[model samples]
Target: MGLPARRPHAPAEGRARGQGGRVMAPFPKIHDLYVSRMVVMTVLLTWTVLVGLDVVNAMISEFGDVGKGNYGLLDAVTYIVYTIPRRAYTMFPTVAVIGALMALGQLAASSELTALRALGLSRRRLSLSVAAPLLVLTALMMVNGETLGPWGQRSADGMKTAAKSKDMAVAQFSGLWAREGDIFLNAQNGQEHADGKDTWLELDDVRLFEFADDGRLESIARVATAEHRKSGWLLRGVKRTYFEGNSVTQTEVMEEHWTSQLDAAALAASASNLWRPRYMSARDLRDGINYRKRNGLDASEFEEHYWGRWFYPLNVLALCLAAIPFAFGTLRSGGAGKRLFIGIVFALGFWLLQMQFVKLAGVYRFDYRIAYLMPPVVMLGVSAWLFRRRSG
Candidate 1:
């Protein structure tokens, strides 16, 4: 039979009538920018506030001696800020993923997301939209690390050293004087140089004396250039001669590798005794390990922190990612302050676990590559899936 007639939407009631029932009000369209911006702000602001507070407290408590030197509150502030960009860059992607998941989840609970779904927007499209901004940030983070992380670390270390020199401890380079018969070597200073790849000796001069077995002075040789080498010092432009019984037996030479009992690490320790675990870069750590390893040096202690460098950024990212699932609903229903307490706990736990894992890996002579890869694999996989499903 011909249709009796379609019921018209109620013109007077301002509602659409459909076969199913009544058409609900159209849902608001989800905006990509709005979601990403909100997430970025929340994560960045939270991280900065929390980290900044911790930094201030740490400086006050532990930096008293360093800050009292040429370094002051201003220097401490500079170093802290310089270090933040690296920390923040690593923190961004993680928070972006988690925050987006969280922001979307909360919206879902409030029905705001449901309304968007009703408007013909699929969960997949919504996820793609939110994750787009994260891709851009990923690029930024890569560049930031390549540029800022290395430089900032270096600046912080220099100021810290000048702020507090390791001049107290006496060592081979600090006041090492060696005299083998007529050959005398006095190193005024020995410190790390050339981006900590090599050790340098500040030599005021050197004095060499030639003597007869009868205890008579035969000749004198003046000092020359003293530079660093892999084996040891490269002393150049040496002038030596012998004068006896109106006859001159003399020799002039330059360029020699001075492999002393003191190794490069030992030299660095003697002069620039101010290095800390946080000072060296990834490359520095690698080279340091190689130098010590080649010389049969027992430096498993520094080796622990050294191996940690290769995975540092990864670890940072992993911690941030692991934090995502926790923020999802762990405290989504709670007050902001309550959520933060849980966040801090998450951060501390992540740090401790990472530290212990790295240390254990080093102590037991575990494979560093596996250890480095594990955290990223676990955290990033879970976080990625968790965020995708949550957003979906």
Candidate 2:
């Protein structure tokens, strides 16, 4: 028999020659590595540009407040510096999706993506490769949100408050101030304290101004410390002075019970770093929710934030994945403007959808967890469909 007919060379779709001309498996790993590096670098560049712009705008706004009280240029700069982490954390999700889009768009423009596709890399596999870097970024952002973001925000607020208020009780931003009926209460400062398994708020140098119904000054009480307990609020080192026309009487007490409609948990939330629920960590949010619930307060807002924090990573990943399909389609022949527009549209749409769901949740009294999940779930479904269609 003649020598066996020479076998035809295999197509290059799933095989490549190694150093010795031996066949190697498809280069999915190499593609993944290459894509990951490009995505990460693009994300950092995007994050820097966006955050820098945001910080500049904030600095301009802060400068306008420099002349107020003791808030000078230096103080304003310090405040802005401290708030940078919070700003970065807040802008990350939007930046990440946009950056991924730009990176893939660049790849498509360069024809590298086309080569990868021709080499039998499915769109789904490519998307997964893109997702790996984004997932890593998402984890880092989550950590920043919980740690640096909250810490920086709290520190910035404290610095601003202190700089603006000398008396610490007269300024609006000084400390905790509240009104319950005819009693106006002010705390020079307040701090959250943890005792084993329990946590509570302690108000230092608490002052209570009891006004008459007709707006006359009736009495004033000063307490060295106000502590919130399970039973009620306890005012220690109390000194009460009564104003009865020309007659005045003073009384001193070791402690007194403060009976009012104010919830300690609510006060604690306000006292702890001027609490903006959006900036708080999930742990703090949970504590707030539990505290408010135990005191029979409406925990809807806290619950909303708590659930949102828990779902942040999922939302980010979904948005990033959803953004990739655009690169494979319109971005292949499009320029940076188109990529940016697509990114903005997706980011804004997702943001608006989330806001609408939150409003609906409030109006309909539904679980906020469901509301937070809806946007990401919808995006994920859309992404899956697009990948399938594109691959087909």
Candidate 3:
């Protein structure tokens, strides 16, 4: 018999197929880029709309107080501008889901997804492509939240306080309370300086109440100005009052070297809603927790906030991923508005559940780490199962 002739490979087939003779590469760069770009643009537009709505609502809410004190319309606008980053961080997860869903729904509606499926792109690969750009966005958001959000929030709050009350500008309470071993510390006013490693707090009118082992008041020290030094606190113009049986004695000193373990981290961490945990960076939260823990202070709140902020991006990505199946399955044939509305509904529910969980955790003394991780884990789990079922 004659030798069997070898057939030449088709040029089109060679170019279109993978090395293993599949119709698609493991990761198609052009397809991934196209999907990523579409998703990113949709997300940006959706996020802008959400932010605008929020801004309008905020302006309306603050309009009532616009003329009060020195807080004019301009001040309100400035305050909104300053706090934009924080708001963006807070609303990111919701807008991310809405945007991704809208993008996927659009593609499905246009039969682009069908074509991709025909080209041998699996759901898993497509999901990853959609997730890639969002991961980058989440990282950028982390940076913005850590750097710009805190600084801007602090400045806006100071401006609002100064406009509202004279005491707030100089001698008002910082709403910070901390316990260091046997001593309890409180500050009427404090200023934060720009120091990356140590959040320097320059306290004005600080009060230190000391207690004995029996929980009796031992003494009270009042300082006009207090700054955290390497060794301890440098208290200027200190007045010490002794609470002894049947005799109360008072002494004053030009300056005193106070030995205490509390630092700027503790003060900033203990600040009330004005300095919320979401504003602090990971490093800030870690340092604060360590300082407070080392000083025999409770760090539960800081730990909770730290974990929540640290897992923020992951939580958002999970929610977005979880939302993909809805866009492709039931909502695939729906209009963009329909998908967006559904996304909003889901986002609102997620926020409500998150808030409720946090509140319940605080009441029940649940583990902060678990409380922070619960939402993301559940979201991702559901997403994985859905994708598996759909693909199977």
The per-candidate count of clashes, in order, stands at: 0, 0, 1
Best by TM-score: 2
Model 2 TM-score?
0.73
Give candidate 2 misplaced runs (Cα > 4 Å).
Answer: 1-28, 169-273
Per-residue lDDT of candidate 2, residues 1-392 (tens digit): 78989977554534565777655654458778899899999989999999999999999999987987788999999988998988988898899889999999999999999988877676766888888888888888889989998888877876676566543322324456777888888886566778799887788778899999899999999998888877778899999999998999999999999876676765765576565678788998897788667756567778888898888888888899888887777889978888888988999999999999988998899999899999999999999888777767
lDDT comparison, 2 vs 3, better candidate: 2
Residue pairs with colliding backbones in model 3 are: 172-188
In angstroms, the error of model 1 at 116 is: 4.4
**In angstroms, how far off is 345's CA in candidate 2?**
0.4
What C-alpha RMSD separates each model from the true structure? 11.2, 10.1, 11.2
lDDT of 3 by residue, 1-392 (tens): 99999996553324567677776544547888899999999999999999989988988887886876788989998988888898888788998999999999899989898877766566776888899999999999889888887777777776765565432331122544556788877675444555767655666667888999999999999888788766677899899999999899999999888777664553553344344455666777787688667756556667778888877887788788888877557676878789888788878877776777777787788887777677777778888898887767
Q: Model 3: runs farther than 4 Å from truth? A: 1-28, 170-273, 291-298
Q: Per-residue alpha-carbon lDDT of model 1 for 255-323, expressed as tens digits?
A: 656555534443354345333334445555566567557645545545666655556556645655555
Q: How accurate locally is residue 203 in candidate 2, as Cα lDDT from 0 to 100?
A: 81
Q: In candidate 1, which residue pairs clash? A: none
